[model samples]
Target: MFNIYKEMWDRRKMIHALSLQEIKKEYAGTVLGSVWGLVNPLMRIAVYWFVFSIGTRADNPVGGAPYAAWLAIGMVAWFLLNDAFRLSQKAFRSKRSIIKNTPFPIAILPAVQITFSFYTHLILLVVILIAMAFALQTVSVYWLQILYYDFAALMLLLGLGSVTAPLVAISKDFGRFLDTVLIFLFWMTPILWPVENAGPLENVVKLNPFHYIVQGYRDSIFYHSGFWEHPLYTLYFWALVLVLFILGNYLYKRMKPIFLDIM
Candidate 1:
């Protein structure tokens, strides 16, 4: 873990540059270009707002804030995480030329995707905050805690990406499997639905690591609650992150040698 992270830290500048290059490459030919990053998610949010808020007639406020405001915060976290996970899995496959020819630090490949997603995440966050200022009409110090949740989300992505990227390289089928899992995770995560008084099912849902993050975003934005207020959940989230980080590094090291052969 130390070695992989140390190398990534040493090559942070390269990672940053590659991440930017990736963002540009992704939208290179589009008329709107990078604007699509913000536009795409905003469109999704509009669709969800229409569906749930209108179609389903579930217009109830969540945590004393408009449902749109609450939903935006959760979606902000999800967009970053989901994009990072999906893109990082392609890190090895996508950068085949670099891997074949350059002495690049493969470990940092996942970080590049995470950073790329993070750029858009920050933009969405700012837009959400502005929307909240108008919608919620108040702000709290707890809003700053979003920085903590963002870090937590990034760490979670790094750990999971490290493990999955190599596995996806080994078998493209794993990438498909990951897609199914992400769909399940999105529904189970309570992003679109309220889990209030969900009984024992709430316990099961919270076991999904993302539940901590989605709820944490709400806590930061709507509930005005500090993360420390939930001590056990906090500990559990970090413990899971630590285990994944360790295991991801272990798998990454074991599989990296075969990546070129498989690709």
Candidate 2:
């Protein structure tokens, strides 16, 4: 494990280059180029704003925060976490040739996806900051909250990717199934609505760990709350994330050698 991690560390340039290449390739043929990063999330924010504000009333208003601004802050952070988690698992399947032709650090593929997730989230984060200044009528001094949630989200993604990337190599069905499940989870999560306001279905919302995660981001940036505010839940989240990583690493080690053949 130590050796694999060290080799990955030594190939920093290659990982950086691959991540850049993936970013360029991402919006290559599009008219807006890299601006798609800003555009897509902006569109999502607008949709959720219209839905919650107009379609249904979303409560827990970020401690006297504007709904638009609240949604922006919470959703942007949630987008980063979910996108990083969902897409990083695609590393092996997306780069079939890179894996088959070269004996490079397969680990970097997920990291590349994670880097792209960060880049896109940064654009949305900037927009949220600007919106917070204008709509919320206050600047956030919750830099530490943002950092805490970002760190927690990264752990979730890193651990998930480490496990899922290898699973994808061994089982393509895992990817397809994950995509299907994410659709269900998007609704099950409180992105378009608040889990706390689930009425009679509140217990159902409580069962999902993701609802708490979304709440974590929303609380951190939108409501200006700190990680320690909900000590028990926060500890639970990290513990679950750690278990995921441990399982992921074991799976990766077991499956990586046989990945190319299955691919």
- Top candidate by TM-score: 1
- lDDT digits (tens) for residues 2-46 of candidate 2: 343455568767767876787898899999998898888889888
**Which residue pairs clash within candidate 2?**
163-248
Model 2 segments more than 4 A misplaced: 1-7, 56-63, 199-209
TM-score for every candidate vs. truth?
Answer: 0.96, 0.88
Poorest 10 consecutive residues by lDDT, candidate 2: 1-10
Q: What does candidate 1's lDDT look like per residue over 91-167, in tens digits?
A: 88878888888977788998999999998788888988888888778888889999999999999898888878899
RMSD of 2: 2.5
For candidate 1, the per-residue lDDT at 220 reads 86
- lDDT for residue 250 in candidate 2, whole number 0-100: 78
Error of 2 at 228 (Å): 1.4
